[model samples]
Target chain A: MKLKTLVLSPQSRLDEVCSEACRARINDYFEPVWNETGRDYTQEELSERMAEAEVIISSWGSPSLTDEMLQKAVKLRAIGHAAGTVKNLVPKQIFAQGVKVYSAAPRIALSVGEYCLAALLTSLRYLPEFDSAMREGKWKIAGLKGRELTGSTVGIISASSTARAFIKLLAPFQVDVLIYDPYLSEEAAARLNAKRATLEEVMSCPIISVHAPKLPATERMLTRELLALIPDGAVFINSSRGPVVDAQAFMEELQSGRFFAALDVFDKEPLAVDHPIRTLPNVLLSPHIAGASVQGHLALMEEVVEDIIRGLREEKTMYEVNEKMWEVMA
Target chain B: MKLKTLVLSPQSRLDEVCSEACRARINDYFEPVWNETGRDYTQEELSERMAEAEVIISSWGSPSLTDEMLQKAVKLRAIGHAAGTVKNLVPKQIFAQGVKVYSAAPRIALSVGEYCLAALLTSLRYLPEFDSAMREGKWKIAGLKGRELTGSTVGIISASSTARAFIKLLAPFQVDVLIYDPYLSEEAAARLNAKRATLEEVMSCPIISVHAPKLPATERMLTRELLALIPDGAVFINSSRGPVVDAQAFMEELQSGRFFAALDVFDKEPLAVDHPIRTLPNVLLSPHIAGASVQGHLALMEEVVEDIIRGLREEKTMYEVNEKMWEVMA
Candidate 1:
């Protein structure tokens, strides 16, 4: 008999993430328990439901699995996270307990790469400025020349999955890529068709993109000195995480109007409602998106479903985030 | 001795189009005659100067080379135009006179391709919509899910030089390309890595870009029925001459908010300041500046300079327009 599976993603995303086709597939193989209430369940509620479910499909609204909660799921053998980064959702003890875990990080990374490319291209052509000027009934402003991506240098702050995907997307331009990832080897960088460089060297390029993780060692990685090294008319893009950049220092540079920036992540999202960066003519701002998309959820959830089915059949599953890799993985 | 060359472009663009380095090279190779006043020269003024010049460097501000003006330049054997499309500046009589002519058409076409790519990437991620929403202090609105360029089908309405370059730029995405061009054969389309399709079939894609010529046979190629056939949420890009699309049909479709359009040209230039298309939320408007850039002029002029030098040596110039080809060439 097929193992019973319980889905614990945010009820708001249940329909979009797991469409009717997905539900029908689950019914064809295993029974599915879908919570009717659009809320995260308490530990007690999850523990009560654990008695019937041997597998769990978790996402944003699922509570972090604790040691106590792990003991309640006596028959549970697998957990599939239907979103990027299982770091906050899965405890270290789960790996020691032999519970398999999988995440949609790879799929989500591609989406982030697409967003970063969009941001980079948009900044190069001054799309925001043109749109704003057109809306204000202004036409053909002087000094509005645009930069082309071809034959320009692009810098990647770190060797994250999104950065890798982004570099792949830029293959046609044949732009020089400088990567600043201390964890990445020179040979690996070369294999990705990029040159390994110091953070300062990377930031000095005409286009610099931040893709480092939000870790203790990476806090304020882009220092004031490094930020200032960015040449005039250069573009700085930040879509990974907030704290990696010295937000105040970056904002001051943008305010100087010597360069441009497209920021999708910030130190404080929803961006203070009236932040000075919001009014900067050279800045393109988006509320902490760049990672999620409606069509993307379909691919993400399908992968999760595949992982869950593989786990139920005791087959080896791809994308399983093991304990040894937890420290570096987001 | 080198040929005597007279630069007849508007004085406003002299320094920009021909930098000190360019002027130094011109002086080294040719007896360069530069206009002192930063203004367009009158036909009589040009006639007076043409008598002494063996070569002419003309741009936007130069009057059309009528047979009467051509007669005045008794020693002229070459004309290098530092801009796109010499059809307006160089009459058929110039070609018939066997005067070597060169244009920056290929370089300008490349810039247009870059702009088209930027527009496509920007629209895919809904950059304009996000910018407008964020400016209004609306953060993270529902139903704001963006589309990614990967795995999507892109439709090209014609196989112009800009279209060819645009297709090359899209090589990294590995998306399916559908092309519609009566002048193109299936073999030629395959060389561009695109499948040939009917115009209606192409318009039904998630992204459709127009690049047909503005000839009598091609006017209003994007009919009202074809405009209505575009898929919902699809992006329509028109960086080529705008008359190819039925203006009223396009405006109506965009006004309905069923899809998005990024238009760099209009049937009417500067688009009547109070036009309804200007205010439509789904439309991204730019003042007809996509075909050229300030930075690009350096390379363009250098090519023109090279052609003039070659022409003086009686070598076959690569960009010389011939009488047999002028009728079909833009």
Candidate 2:
């Protein structure tokens, strides 16, 4: 018997998350609702679809499943999200109804990790300076000498999924990794092949990457004092949320030219035209595209589809998230 | 008893290659000539110093040891070169005298390998485009999508020392590597964890890196047809000598917007003032500084010093270069 699954995401994003093969697998396994409709359903429309949907497939931009929605979705058994986090999309009400939830967080974490690794290695080589010099017809410039990642110490903040993935990717390089994660035990750090360090000690490394989740405790963890503690010529990277770092302090640090940074996220999206960091040569900024790789989306979709199949069979779910897990997860 | 050693290199480059500790060790192990002098001796001056010297320490800018110089260097048992290759520095006369020759080629190869890995990862992520766009205050570009190295096929042009070191570094990444070195047998390719591929098949990969030595048979191996066969959106990297690749074909490919390139060496260096490739947004150009990292020079010095100590002790030198090895080595 095939479960009736309703995909709650905007139709335009369906192909972006799920490859054609993945979509075919979902169709083959589940009696999908509205196979070809490109509709982002309104509340009234969702109410009609909820009447028959035993399982829901959600992704980025899907409307939150509230208590009232759950009351209508009496048969709703599970949600498989083809995106990193289910925090914003899956509410406590669904769990109250004894619904199961799974996400593509692990796959998204790997993609972000790959991006961070690339950013760190690129900054270490002083690639931006060389690229600009080449464009301007300058052969070489002062302070543009390349540095090798080997024999250098790398500092990682947080034991978040992305950070763990990044650490795994670094196994081949002969580098010492220092990790600053209050939630992580010393033994846990050793298991990750990283040395446990205080925030100050982590900041002192020549290469520091932040992957802490955005929360009340982690917000502003990298304060003015912490940012200033970083060594000169160190490459500071933040693919995590901006508030997790003291943005003002970071801007000041960049202005002082004491260190370099590669940032994917900022406190504000589309940072103002007059923002000083935008013009700084020591900074490498991207428009929050670290987790937006095409392959990342496809991988997430595959994970979600597999979870859906597993849910139907009542097998163990590797990426499930409950209300308790949500409280601590990024 | 300390062996008598004469330093033949220019004085200015001493600190760049040999660190203070290295110089101290050399002084303790050997009765080094003048302990500290910046003089680059002429052939007559070298011949005068060679009479008592049991070993010679050489580097860049040291004059070649000719037949007449060798006749005067009756006591010379070995020549330690603190640089990449000894071909240009060690003449046939040195070999005829049964003088052992050693070079810092292995250390130099590692540094070049590190640079190439950094270049490959940087290009894979479209980092140059992102850096330039961010500098220009553009938050998002049309085609600045990031690509993960996982599952990507990388094509290597040779089984050179640098290429072998690079293969080791890539062990952690989930990538398939293909090699097109004619000298490499199928078994040898497997040992390097790379599959053997023809030039045409190699060029078809999404990422192509050239590490082939500059030789008569290998020169211009990446021909016009081969360059055109490269898949669209692929990254073409050449940290090796430029003549190994067909320059005109590569330039034409870049102009057509079919692929991107990261080039350290060029066909005509300080590439012409009005070179079209210089200003292309898709091309990344560096002033041939891949193997010029500061640490690279230090490592080379350390290797040469160790080889000198081993040579004096009459032990087998790991870095010793024989006539047979020199012909095939880069």
Q: Candidates' TM-scores?
A: 0.93, 0.96
In terms of lDDT, which candidate is strongest? 1
| Model 2 DockQ vs. reference | 0.67
lDDT of 2 at B21: 86
**For model 1, how does the per-residue alpha-carbon lDDT over A1-330 read when each residue is reduced to its tens digit?**
777888886557776677667777877876778776678777678877876768888876777777778877788888888888888887888888888888888778888888888888778878777776877887887888777787889999989888998999888887999999998998999999999999989988999999998888899988899998999989989988888888889888888999988888888777777777777788787887787776677777678888777765778877677887776675
Residue pairs with colliding backbones in model 1 are: none
Q: What share of the true interface contacts does each candidate keep?
A: 0.61, 0.65
lDDT of 2 by residue, B1-330 (tens): 777988776557786788878878878888888434466777777777777888888887777777777777888888889887877777766776788899987787777777777777777777777766776778877755777778889998888888887888788777899998888899999888899998898889999889888878778988999888999988888888989988888788889988878898888887776677878878777888777777788766668888878876888787899888777665
Task: Assess candidate 2 and give its lDDT.
Answer: 0.81
> Cα lDDT for residue B14, model 1?
72
How do the residues A123-167 of candidate 2 rate in per-residue lDDT, one tens digit apiece? 877777787777777776765577777788999998889999888
Candidate 1 chain B, which ten residues in sequence have the lowest lDDT sum?
Answer: B292-301
lDDT of all the models against the reference? 0.82, 0.81
